[model samples]
Target: MTTNAELAARFEEFADLLEADDVEYKPRAYRRAAENILAHPVPIAEAVESGDEDAIDDIEGVGDAISSKIVEYVETGKIEELEELRAELPVDIADLTRVEGVGPKTVGVLYRELGIETLDDLEAAAEAGEIQEVKGFGAKTEQNILENIDFARTVGQRHLVGEARPLADDVLAYLEGIAGVERCEVAGSIRRWRETIGDVDVLAATDEPDAVVDDFLAWDSIDDEIESGPAKASVRVGEMRVDLRLVVPGEFGSALQYFTGSKGHNVRLRNYAIDRGMKLNEYGAFDVSELEADPDADPQHVGGGQRVGERVAGETEESMYDALGLPWIPPEIREDRGEIDAAEAGALPDLVTEADVRGDLHTHTEWSDGNNSIEEMVAAAENRGYEYYGVADHAQGPGVVGGMGLSEAEILDQVDEIRAIDDEYDVHVFAGIEANVDAEGAIGLSDEVVDALDLIVASPHSALDQDAETAGERLIRAIENPAIDVLGHPSGRLLNEREGLAIDAGALGEAAAANDTALEVNANPRRLDLWGSAVQAAIDEEAKIAIDTDAHRPATLEFVRWGVHTARRGWAEPNDVVNTWELPDLESFLH
Candidate 1:
């Protein structure tokens, strides 16, 4: 069976190939269609299998042409047009594009000029100095590719949480509906909302483990069963690996807690328990003060042997932590980084929730590369009951793609349009611009352009290969620019795509705090820049943060939740995020 991920991947490849062929318009169309399909709540393949041809129409960006392709792949496991494209330009577009400076156009050039088709081929051509022989290719560009080839090859093994979570949700929903399964939930780093996931780990509570395992093995979305047993199973669903573990209902909570761990957290907690003459493990917390414990036991195993003493708690996760005389630590903050100590001192933060955000400060529309219009994107924000929304389209500067930025005249016209719509609905629409920060940390927006907007989100778009000190200084200078309201995607990194820049988070935080600029936790999964650890550093400096989605369309507007979770992982509270404040407070911060 084709999972949503599998179906979406085909279209992504379709888009890449189309872009490489220099096909205009259709590539963006295919990419948007692919995005909608990937984010669709249900499995489109299963809907097609059920003979619902209209399933494709239900997806927002998909139209007749893309719909037929979806149906074809679902029915026959092949897209004929995609196959033809592959035959025409037989290069590994995905792998080649993974290199830092390489893109679809680069792939096309290399494949045509140097007959490079794979990472090995690209590497060979670069090593033999054949790449530089091609026009438009230089020593620096070839060296850049050679440097990034191996890194790109190694990073593909992991999946992004944005891609894997939907699959995990589908799996959990499926297992919950199966007979004899009482409770089901996701586990592992996915549970912690980590940016990248190794695999989806799920746990099931059941009285009949064998029955539940059998039903899970029969899941229609599964592509291959890696292994199976009465209470455990592993399966391959598309490119993601899923491991399911079953425990009796009596130990469900403990099992959930055990599986949802950052190894450091579990180890720290177990040692804390040991210091108290107690034991903690997957089986549950135990009061083993009176029992003989072995010091020579394997240090790698938590509590050594499971169920070794009088079981204090196992039925509920809260109880397990209660047994340790501490409050339950949130999974996001359970990365050992002083969380156990914080819990002991009753100093755990009240992490910000998704509902707390009042608006998104950085977003896009048809004025830039975004698919939607400003009116349409604003409608989406109002639909979510946002008190305010910011329309920050791209401004022409360095790294602004293909003149997809607003000129000064365009900025003035957009401000007029935004003012006309500010109170048109129940929301406040703030006119904004996402200005590109140049190599020397200058935002190219003129005084007239900056004065015309209510917000400015300055972001680094190019020169991402600077040393740590250079990057930190560049970002600090940008942050100090009085006209800039938010610093966007601090590192500019794209998960599994590129290691964008090397930034010192602590120094950036200091600069941002001193300048009263809010650091952005860009919610876009591929670029969750100012990731958890960085956010924490910013928080330590008492610098404000904005959990903006950097949304390019309506569907992506909801990606703010990913940002909220990343902030939680950073120990951020409602007060730390400017958008989480009331409308008046947010407006004051903007001013």
Candidate 2:
């Protein structure tokens, strides 16, 4: 089964190969095929296994030839055409093109001109002044390549939604508060609530574009300036690229709609407009060629590029949806996850709200891995006006191998301290333990210790090597334990770095619901496991969800916004999420 990400990459590689050969039309075909593959609702393998090429054709933008290739790959576990193309080029393509700004043409040129086949070889050529000798290659390009090569080497592939999300929020809040800015939003993949991000893109409608761009460039946290134009600016905030675009109010919504794209989604929406006798573009819908309402015309060309629908007001996102006769689509659902279908069907979920959240369930104190003391953690929750908080510290068995965990005795000893301090706070603070689940599918803490706590968060911290079936069963057994209140970070994955344990999320979700155990959407930014898709599966199973920061410090508690965003992306509604329950309901659920 090729994951959407993997399939997308393969298509991109094919497109790049075509570009290297200067092949026309084929690149667009492959790119379109890739888009459809990523947007597919079910596994491509399933559709192909049944010998149904219609499944491929059913996907928007996928044609017969591409579908045939997909079927070929599915039937034979190989793409002969792609393999042939790769063999022909055979120039360490993936590696050489990975250099930022170096595309397939540049790779072809470098290989032909300098015989540079690897990163080290490229570095050697650049150092020896060999690259500038090639046509269309200059000193600036070589320097840029060298400067970004280290970045390309050291930089992680993509940032998880958890990690990229916070920085975006901080930047948005700052920009939104600016005096002349009318509306600010995150666009691109982030707006679509993608699982990973290459860069953080922000779009804003401002009365003062110059001032806004100036202020953005002057952001105190900016580590380096990449480029600055009149309407847009790019900066390197730590390792991530942050791009800010300023536009006039009249063009805001259209730009938002244009930029907040999965590309496939945009193409679909554009076709929808074309079918309705309207032309959709970055500026707004416009009158194009009118088809009909014509009795004699083909239905496919009825509205053929005509701009019949009303223009969205204010050029902002909300108005853009209104122009399309739909409500505003949230960022997460913009991935084409039946969002357009829901829009056309008029049955989209209301989605969860931050205000619906009543308490912070999973937290930590200095007794274990966290930085804040029990009292301080409680005080912070109280300051947030939370009705309650759950203090869950790490249990000893995972060991101090990471210098971030506690001993089982120390965890037990902290209960008395938690109880003693509980009396001083206005809100309820439930004592809990974040116990480790060993490789053999068993939690480290004894039932005696687990039962002693008000809540037990069982999580896999080691031996994340089991196959999907085995790991799913392991987690299902843990969820069935009457003593365990929650399953923590079901997949131990770390963003952009590790894949973590493999498990069948649908099965785990069913077990969670059946056993009356909740699943923790660990919102650590690095480990937003039980991601939006998994959260949706849990929702389907009637399982409860807790969005916890797993915060190790007081400042980190603010990460709840990311968790909330992720939950909303999963199409969670207020009632569907357990954290939305008030204190009494929470206690009943936990018990």
Candidate 3:
């Protein structure tokens, strides 16, 4: 089956190839279509299998041309046009363009001038000092490629949480529906809500392991069954690898604990158990000191003795931790970074949750690159029962691609529209701009335009390659701008695609704290900037935090959950986030 993710990747590659070949307009069109398709509620394969071409075409950014191509790929498992373009370019555009400083145009230039078609070829050219010989590529450019190539290679393996999550949910639902399955839950990093995941791990409690395994193998979503046994099965679903383990009801809790681990956390728990004359393993937590030690016995046995000793705790995760004299720690904070001590001391924070957020402060509309209109976005926020909604469209400036940012005049016009819309609904609609902060730390909008707004979300959209000292200073300047309310997506990193700017978070947080500006946890899964550690540093400095979706469309507003959990991981409470306040209080804080 052609998953939406797979289809999106194809269209994105088509865009890159088109841009590389100097083709005009089509690249952006293809890229937009790709983005919409990925976000579409329905699966592309299901729509294609229904033979409903209009259903595919109805996707926000897709048109007849892209729709036809999608159908072709769905029916034949290939698109001839894309294949032709790949043959023509004959370059690994995706891999090469992933380097921080490289884009499709640079990839094309390197390919045309030096026949650099792959990372290996690019590396060899950079090493041999050949890339510098190319016309526009200088010695510095060559050196940067060599430095970033290694990072890019390692990034390609992980899938963004947003992309892998839907498939995981589907698999869980499918397994839960099967008879004889007693309990099921997702384990591993997904359970911990990591920003990115390598694969999905599911654990099920069932008396009939053989029946459960057979049911899993027969799942329609399975593209390939990699391995199968009475108790476990591994399958490939779209671009994700899913591993399922069926354990007896008795050991479900212990198995979950063992599987949902950050290796280091488990090691700490094991040592703690050993100190108490107990043994902890996947099967259960058992007291093993009374049993005689048998050095020659098979270590695979649960407790390394014929008598497994007194059973202490194993039926529930809470009990397992209770047996160890600690509170049940939230999975998000299970990074072994003082969480165990906090649990033991009964000082674990009451973490922020999805329900605690009052509204979204950073969102876009058709005035910028967003698919939905201002009215539509506000309605979506209202649907979520938010106390307030901020419409922060991109302000016209450098790095604002495809003329997606609003001009000074357009921004003023949007304010009127927002005000009129505000009167029509219960939700307070605050008109604002996601103004670009230049390298020198100046916002793009004029003082008058910025002052007239209810909120101002200043973000660094360009000069992302600056070093730590420079980036820190650049962000500090933006924070100091009196008109700025929130420093959006502070680092500008795009998950695996780009490393973005490097800065000292503690210093940046201090500057933000001093300036009375809030730093954003931009919850667009791919760009969960001010990631856990950075969020913690900001919190330590007493700087305010805002968890906004940076939503480009109505449906995207739900991404706030990702931001909320990320804040929780950083020990941020409801009081720490400005958006968690009521409308009047939030407005007062902004003022």
Highest lDDT against the true fold, candidate: 1
lDDT value for model 1: 0.88
All candidates' lDDT scores? Answer: 0.88, 0.75, 0.87
* Clashes per model (N, Cα, C within 3 A): 0, 8, 0
Judge candidate 3 at residue 254 and give its lDDT.
86
Kindly report which residue stretches of model 1 are placed more than 4 angstroms away from their true locations once superposed. 299-304
Worst 10 residues of 1 by lDDT: 297-306
Clashing pairs in 2: 252-315, 253-315, 253-316, 277-306, 278-306, 278-307, 286-307, 288-307
| lDDT digits (tens) for residues 148-227 of candidate 3 | 99988888888888787777788888988999899998999988888889999999999999988998898877889899
lDDT of 2 at 374: 88
Model 2 regions lying over 4 Å from their true place: 1-155, 160-182, 206-230, 287-314, 399-411
Q: Rank the candidates by lDDT, best first.
A: 1, 3, 2
The digit string of per-residue lDDT tens for model 1 on 1-591 reads 787778888888998898888889888788878777776767888788888878768787888888888889988889999999999999988888888998888898888888889999999999998998899989988888888889899877788888888888889889989989989889999999999999899998999988888888888778899999888999999889999999988898888888999899988988898888777778887887877645787532434567777888988889889998999999999898899999999999999999888899999998888888888999999999998999999999878776789888998999999988786888899999999888889998788887778999999999988888888888999999999999999888888889999887888888888998999999988888889989998999889999999998888887897899999999999999999889888777774
Q: List the residue pairs that clash in candidate 1.
A: none
TM-score of every candidate:
0.96, 0.67, 0.95
Worst 10 residues of 3 by lDDT: 298-307
RMSD (Å) of each candidate, 1 decimal? 1.9, 19.2, 2.3
